[model samples]
Target: MRRWAMQAGLCLALCAGAASAAPAPTWRGLDPDNTLVIDTSQGRIVVEMRPEFAPQSVARVKLLAREGVYDGLLFHRVIDRFVDQTGNPNNRDGGTSSHPNLPPEFDFLLKPDAADAIASRASDGITGFVGATPFSASQLPRPDGTLRAAGAYCAGVVGMGREEDPGTGNSEIFFMREPSRRLDRSYSVWGRVVQGLDVVRTVAIGEPPAHPDRMIKVRVMADLPATERPKLEVMNPRSAAFAALIRKVRAAKGADFSICDIDVPSRSQP
Candidate 1:
């Protein structure tokens, strides 16, 4: 029965973007150990990660970033009002990484509100789907007879990390092409395009001959000196208030678990 409960918990975490499977461990929070700042010819874009949420994926990116693996990498694929994908060491064919395929880190119930916030949306109220699963909530959950604000899942063009493909994430990543209301609960969003969006908009679209955009280098802004780095302060979810909320929620739910068990929301890139 304990084993079964563990399995059940694992399943729930997978749904929440926490664990990929029973065998793999989950990420803790931002990989301050290996943060990155993407430098494009057009401009620089900063990314703050949450390794606690997806540790394996974050470690994989750090490994690649430190080796300068993504340096001179091309944004091999781009779609207007959509995503730009890269990470193929060769920028040709489906990119392969040194790591093995990872399991899905789903942590659904852990952060329903945040998940809803990032979910993709259509012009109509209807929600979208990915891999045959609906991403966002069409209606709000009211468990105690009280009205709750309608919540959504992650949407829009999100930074893509490998799911079910462990080490497969290496240096490759993708941006959402548009608001993906349906994908809110399905994918793990590592970071966002905080700057140089215009350059991303101007990326050469289409496959091959027309694929002109490329990532010259990717660095972590925090790692740089104050004068050289951009003015940015990533909200540390470890703050006292944030930690208190997690305790309150867990206590209210009558659950005994690590604070890491709660899904902390990601603040939008400024």
Candidate 2:
């Protein structure tokens, strides 16, 4: 049985009632432009894209969304504790897109004080949000004692899965279901699941789910019909409010704090 089904069964056994209502919305630092609304069979999953860190990947996702390439695709590959991947028109192995393949954007320089906010003792690196997307950074000091950093991978991150060639990532994207620090330098980190994480956790698990879930519809928030569009607010990682949240979380977790522990806050409205 799928993890989601098992969990749902557990909920039914324990609660003996309908699922509880969702929490009230808490609007924070809103990024209206970069959000993507994905309606899947399970539920709606909202992703906030980061062009600053992975401009090409963001551009590719936007283009695919606008062109309607992602609609009706299966969550072809989903492993319980690792990731759930899709966006292959050929199902799992044979899909291709008219869009050109992109070179890897594995690492980039940190913008401003992002370095100070998510100082990661777990990986000897740093982690923080650029817009609503959470990222970790690996660094080594130069001869002049200046540190150069690259993005790190954590849970909720959406990354490109590639073939043998590092530059072949065109349309295959996956959601990180758990923290796989080993992928930090390998895959290109592009966006994050800001809302509907519970839905993500329920995706059918298998290399190919026996009954795979599909993305019913995918839209860039900008492209949605005006009345149908969702208003989303995500805490700006670079803001004082987010800084305070980070401090509070660090204090609470202490030695147990990992970048994956933080889920950048976001709220959505129809």
Candidate 3:
């Protein structure tokens, strides 16, 4: 069972600009405490947390993860074209940890990154990244220029799964293998997949999958011993290579480009 039902659909077709060879990218380190290393039955998937969007939700996940509450939890309800749900201790909708429920975090106060990495523009809103998570905000800022909006539910995005009561956001969470734009502004998105999206896509599918896939072990990257920690680096959003990639993509897409089309690149740090 899942805390909330999640759905996926056929992928939307978008133009992918070809990336040309460039100088080695300048790497940015992911905050270990904010990165989740989910080693599933099939493989490992790395999720980068966005505390800026849902600090409480992020805290809840970190607490349970650090406590080993998610180990061996089944991907209880996986939809073929939709989300992969898990993290329910009782494996049911009402299942939760001893911790209290949290209020809904449907949207966050949006602020611009120091880099000029704008991805999309609408009459009133613009989309940009907060550590690889794409979010949109209003052009008409508040009197003080602090706008607010939700992040997009792009494929491979990680979100908090809640039941009927908005405050029931606790243990259960889901990974989006397919984009669910309708979920934007309705669910609390806390992270994005930085690696192993393939592992997420390979989770066995079923309402309650017979012989379902499960997480072998879930750990906050910071909790892992130095010898066990993953060495990875993400492309600096402000890097010239990244900026060039974005320019190529925006130009190739012409008027059809969107934030969803920009896949943030990462690599293992040698």
Candidate 4:
């Protein structure tokens, strides 16, 4: 009984160590082509869409935004502490662009030539960062030696929506207000909010908000006039400082460490 108690105490201590908060991160400029600006009833939210993981989804979103298809779209479906969903042209639950539905890019295969900074590894899989986005992937190789992985659905993640078939997803999108484990791999995460998360959280919450907030204007950074452009940046997770950050977080979290716990540092200037 005494030995059992001692082991339990030790386990508790280790778990406590694994839950500690990490220090802040360093920063770098964002690529304008990959950046998007959304002005909503709540305020402005800027997202950095990743083409490396979901090129077609990113392209579709970019096409819709540049063409003013998203302007005045309602935050049609919102659920508190979950997601702020919108981009349905009809301002109802279901709508899509004239474009054909897209196949899911729920997870992508990482070739050896891919750029990534691993945070943790196990026999079967690894968790790490790929351009400020956290990802979990298998360590086992495919026939081509590439690894399969999906993004960690942390807060502020932007994902496309589909009602029935995964392929039905087109212009609709949603933003994470909190970490959603179940949504990972079920939805394609194409981008994350680098700034204005507070605004995102403030959006009216309801299955269909009683007074739903609407996107006043949405644009790809490249389409915005120079004067209207907002500059955004994220701390490079692949850098030496980020390596220091990983060590600090890992030491603090111990066995509890997860890539989802690392908040990629960012800044925005309007």
Candidate 5:
């Protein structure tokens, strides 16, 4: 009995030590100069914002997150095999941030090679590129028989979330509808779902009742007390293969591929 108790005590002590050593959650690939961490009740959603990419949009989101404006919100929109959209703080109708909406920041004439080179160079620390860039469907070449650029304006397919009226994205945000290949070059992908995807998947939908799933609260890691502070790590820029692939696509077509175009590899548990 004494031996068993000793072993149990030792295990508990080791577990506590391990917990203390665990790294805190953080936004990856974030520029220390400007970044925001969105802490939801479900888990932490880190955002490495690019004010240079979309200044007004990033500012709005940062302001909302910082002011505790998104607390007690819900997911609101969750489609199976698609994305889960949120940012409605009120939980009544769709919620907008404290500030007024701005006009759209659409730049449809980005050159593919130029964009690729810029991204590659930026990742190499050669230059500083912040904020998200805009894209248009007409830039992507069709893969089918036509082999021409598809001229569709599917906004929110790849860039920062905003309404059609440009500068309309307030507190509300949406995830990808799917692995959208068509959106590869036309939208700014600010961040991705790193954890709690299952929570997103499990959110209750709305229709007849019109309640939809909601976020209980949204907090920023920086806002939390030091005892509850999260650890952060920056993601390395695209791998060589990824960078080369972008170059190849840009050469064949006339647009750069969005991060959504890449497949996420599966990881094994330790």
Candidate 6:
């Protein structure tokens, strides 16, 4: 019994020492420079833009949001267990937007350094974070020996909605409720919902509800009163803690794991 107690005590001491050696988790704060807040009847949905992935689309979204074009817009089409569409001032299919039609910006080629930092590897592609934004990428080796990559369409992906003519997308956007791999590299994915997704899930159901729920307001966090702006932080995907999390998740899911299965955990200040 004394030997067993000694063994237990030693194990506890070792664990305490190991815990002290481990760095405390660090969280990166939200950059209002590219953050947006969508106010709705349900609640507020926060989005973080990834201009590096889709510069033109991100520019257009920021332009429209600054002009207040997204305010008072209705979620015209919300398919159950799928994506929800909005961002049209006219609130109808095929209606014109105040902004000019933006050319398609499907994906971007990552810089060489960006390619080397890839974290999660899957049969489909590699996943990593550019800042706090989680992205899955398909890499291609260039003739010059450099690598190029395109973004993946995972859950919470903010994609520009276009008509039959793909280049016609201007002011319409859709939020993915699930991973729609079919749309990856085919649509202009510009940003992702980083907070308040529960509000997105609660968006009123409708192919077009008789009285559809509307956006109460939409503002760039940078444009809001300083004190009114949301304070949010996301887990650093490049951190040792994040790598450990991925390993634990992979161990649990085994071959079934996909990059979309992991979310960069986040918290918003009250």
Q: Best candidate per TM-score, number?
A: 3
Listed in order, each prediction's TM-score against the native is 0.55, 0.80, 0.87, 0.86, 0.53, 0.84
- Model 3 C-alpha lDDT per residue in residues 1-270, reported as the tens digit of each score: 121111011001001121225543467888998999999998999999999889999999999998889999999999987899999998756688888888999898764332125566576677777777878776554543356768889888999999987778889999998888899988899999999888999999998999899999999999889898878888876567777777889999998887777888889987
Q: With candidate 2 superimposed using the best TM-score fit, by how many Å does residue 70's alpha carbon deviate from the native?
A: 0.7
Instruction: List the candidate numbers ranked by TM-score, top first.
Output: 3, 4, 6, 2, 1, 5
Where is model 2 poorest over a 10-residue stretch in terms of lDDT? 11-20
Cα RMSD (angstroms) for every candidate in the order listed: 12.3, 13.3, 9.5, 8.6, 17.8, 10.3
Give the Cα lDDT of each candidate: 0.47, 0.72, 0.80, 0.81, 0.43, 0.73
**Leading candidate by lDDT:** 4
Clashes of 2: 2
Ranking the candidates on lDDT from highest down gives: 4, 3, 6, 2, 1, 5
Tens-digit lDDT string for candidate 2 (1-270): 454454344334322211235422234543546778899999998887877778898889888888899999999999887898998888795476898889998876653333324435333544655555666644333333323454556778888878878899899898888778798868888878888877888999987889999998988887777787666666555455666677888889998887677767765543
Give the backbone clash total of model 6: 0
RMSD of 4: 8.6
Looking at model 3, how many pairs of residues clash? 1
Name the 10 consecutive residues with the lowest summed lDDT in model 4. Answer: 10-19
Q: Is candidate 2 or candidate 6 better by lDDT?
A: 6
The residue-by-residue lDDT of candidate 6 on 1-270, one tens digit each, is 754554344334323422456664556777787998899988889998888878888888888888888889999998766788998878977776776898878767654444312456544555666654556654333444233455666778788898989789888888887778788767888878888777777787788966677788988889999898887887765456676777887788887887677776788654
Please state the error at residue 251 of candidate 4 in Å: 2.3
Error in Å for residue 241 of model 5: 7.3
Q: How far off is residue 79 in model 1, in Å? A: 1.4
User: lDDT by residue for model 5 over 134-156, one digit each (tens)?
Assistant: 22222222232111111111222
